[model samples]
Target: MTVNQQILLDNRPTGEAVESNFKLVQSPLPTLEDGQVLVRHHFLSLDPYMRGRMNESKSYAVPQPLGEVMLGGTVGEVVESRHPKYQAGDKVVGMGGWQEYSAVDANVPGALRKVDTTHVPLSYYLGAVGMPGVTAWYGLVKIINPKAGETVVISAATGAVGSAFVALAKARGCRVVGIAGGPEKCSYAVSELGFDACIDYREHTDVKTMAKALKDACPDGIDGYFENVGGYIFDAVLLRTNAFARIALCGMIAGYDGQPMPLANPALILVNRLKLEGFIVSEHMEVWADALTELGTLVATGKLRPRESISQGIASAPAAFLGLLKGKNFGKQLVKLI
Candidate 1:
């Protein structure tokens, strides 16, 4: 008999998330059903959006239930299988949550997908070639729809989703600018990621100052914006956007802990005739095949380079998630479970 280790959400967080909110336990594995496959997770992805799931408030997705396994994406191998669709030793990706093993039903839609790890690293399925990659593709190709010689700006530019957007937009001949927390991330964005310029948001104390700096960085004005960090960053981007610009509202990590943060310049949307659209990638399943095909090709061919900040064990996931919310993660944050 095998023992499965799991992390359960103990409590809903009030402000900042603490390790106490999650509880770890071990249990004996249950018998596999007729159409079920058993997976041993090797890697678990820790993304910023999981913060929203911790809350009880209404949002794009349903709030995570308490005392259940904390929700997450996982890449692992099938250890045992009773399902015809999957066999032992097959690599799969699914919503395996924070656990060492998952019993997945093969008949459910969007439950699991087989992956070939020969070309790209197995971990790439959790970040670059998975949800985040598709997120970048959806926002750019479907929303912003940039043309050659246009300027595209993204916040949290060195992160999994943002970095992918940088590579995608650059490939389309659009000049890209990034906004990051410190000088190091800014430097990484410009030097390693091929960004035209990067702004260190820490240098500016207020939105006005940051807007001034953003204007200087985007001299031609921002034609497309991919917003990750809201609040002042949105204000700064709005100040530099052109008349017919498009903005894809991906995330707003700053206010996820507490009350909603109001935009400093909401009127600019109407004044500039901007097309501002908020999207939830999970809700749009139609584009996954096309998005993954392009993203996987770019990563395999050396055109897209995504960085990772990996934690060594499943026990480190809570801290890694907290650090990501604080902007301490340098790139895609993951917890190695194997």
Candidate 2:
């Protein structure tokens, strides 16, 4: 028997989540029964959405129950298998929660997906070539449908989803502008991520200043917008949107800590005749195959190179996740379990 380290949601956050909210415990790995496979998690994904799930209130996802393994996406390898379809040493991606290992029932469809890491890194199956990339695809293709040469803008510009959005939009000949927290992120968004302009939102704190920066970055007015950070960025982007502009509302991370993030100028939506839609990527699973194919090709061809901010060891997960909530992580936030 092997010892497994696990992080469990110990208490629901009253406001902002803290490290104390989670409890770490070590336990013996369960013996694999028939139709079960044991995976040794290589990496655990830390996403903003998990913050919302931490609350006990009603929302899009079920409130993460207390005293359980924190829900998360993971990439790992099969160390032991009692199932016929899988063998030891198989690389796989799954919702294995926050733990060093998981005993998955291989019979459950979509519970574990075997991945080929010859061309693409296995960890990418949790980021660029996985849900984040698919999220960018859905928001850009299905909702914000921008034509070539149109101006597209996104908040959290250098994050996992934004990185994918920039590549897809650039390939389509759209001029992309990004809004990020600091000068470093802004520069990386423009110089590395290939954005037309990247606004450092820290410099423009209020809606007026932010909107002015948007005006300068997008002279043609924003035709499409992928919204992650709401409040100031959302209000600012709305002011700069062209007539018939489409906005894909992804994550309102500004209000994730239970803070109120009311739109300061929602009348602009009507004034500009803009279309806005909020989406949960998991709800749109049908287009994932096509999205992954394109993303993988971009990655394989050396077009879409995404960065990662990985924390070492499972013990770092709680602290790393808190940093991620504060815009501390660049690109995708992950914790290496091995």
Q: What Cα-based lDDT does every candidate model obtain?
A: 0.91, 0.93
Q: lDDT tens digits, residues 109-217, model 2?
A: 8899999999999989999999999999999999999899999999998999999999999989999998888999988988888989999988999989999999999
* Candidate 1 per-residue C-alpha lDDT over 1-338 given as tens digits, one digit per residue, 9 for 90 to 100: 38998999999998989999999888888689999999999999999899999999988989989999999999999999998989899999999999899999988988989999999899999998999999999999999999999999999999999889988998899999998989999999998888999999899858999889888888999999998888888987898999999999999998898867888788999999999999999988999999999889898898888899999877888898999999999989999987
Would you list the clashing residue pairs of candidate 1? none
Q: In model 2, how many backbone clashes occur?
A: 0
By summed lDDT, the worst window of 10 consecutive residues in model 1 runs over 257-266
> Which segments of model 1 are wrong by more than 4 Å?
none
- Candidate 2 clash pair list: none
Q: What is the TM-score of each predicted model, taking all chains together?
A: 0.98, 0.98
